[model samples]
Target: MNVLAFFTATVQTTRGLWRIGQTILGIIFRHPIAGTSIIPILSDGRIVLIRRRDDGLWALPGGMVDWGEDIPSTVRRELMEETGLELTKIRRLVGVYSSPDRDPRIHSICVVVEAEVEGKMEVQDALEVIEIQAFAPSSIPQEPMSHDHYRQLQDYLNGLTTLA
Candidate 1:
């Protein structure tokens, strides 16, 4: 190989090895995270979804469980932060997803819930959410969603409480 080509290949190899090393270290040092994904159903029977600023794909409105906070509190906080809606009631537990590959950013167990919500629909967290919209069951977007949200929604729609 020419000198320039050999140098380019060496740098690429080093970068790839560095990423692999980081992944290994992270797995050894870190633990699985806990989070929530809410299926926010308005009184009118529409579900609320948010367009994430990170990937620009629509996702359920929920977030991680904070320190000293339980799942129910996380659900309420995330619901308001992402959708600007008040939680009238947590109607049911949809599922608990714990696959290591569920969230690309980290190994997270997501507790999905169906909640009755009220108030105006707005994007409260501009840093994380781009836009917020409510969709009827038949009107939800058909495109691929971020994370395992598609599966979560399907489990709820099918009336099956999942543990995965």
Candidate 2:
């Protein structure tokens, strides 16, 4: 009857149908979904991360790529929705992470990028992000990161030092 309940019911029903489609189509096709993650580095060299509401792990700002959206746009959209930071500039492509085991949710190819952000980053949606923080690469949490986020950070850091 209420809006929240109605939304929940709708989402649940949609999820059920989606899973059924996944099962049926997966029998013959291997289409991997696309996702985007952003590493927002500040002027002080600290990177921004969000504490996910579902798992309480501090991870990079990102989400699944929406249909008909380009990777950069997906990155910007997810960053804004999750971190409330507008993407002023995209620095570079960090990498394309496609390890099947990276995320347990589904088969996805995550395009990672380093981006420069403007404005304060508050958790825009409590359902997706619980808290937000910036950390020097050395001080980032070692365990319980949502997916392959820590590995992505290491790759980016390695590239940075080697370039210097």
Clashes of each: 1, 0
CA lDDT, every model vs. true structure: 0.87, 0.80
- lDDT (Cα, tens digit) per residue for candidate 1, span 70-111: 998989999987888999999999999999998888787889
- What TM-score should be assigned to candidate 1? 0.82
Q: Please provide, for model 2 over 53-116, each residue's C-alpha lDDT reduced to its tens digit, 9 standing for 90 to 100.
A: 7788889999776558798888888898788888989999888888877877667778889998
Candidate with maximal TM-score: 1
Report how far residue 6 has shifted in candidate 1, in Å: 50
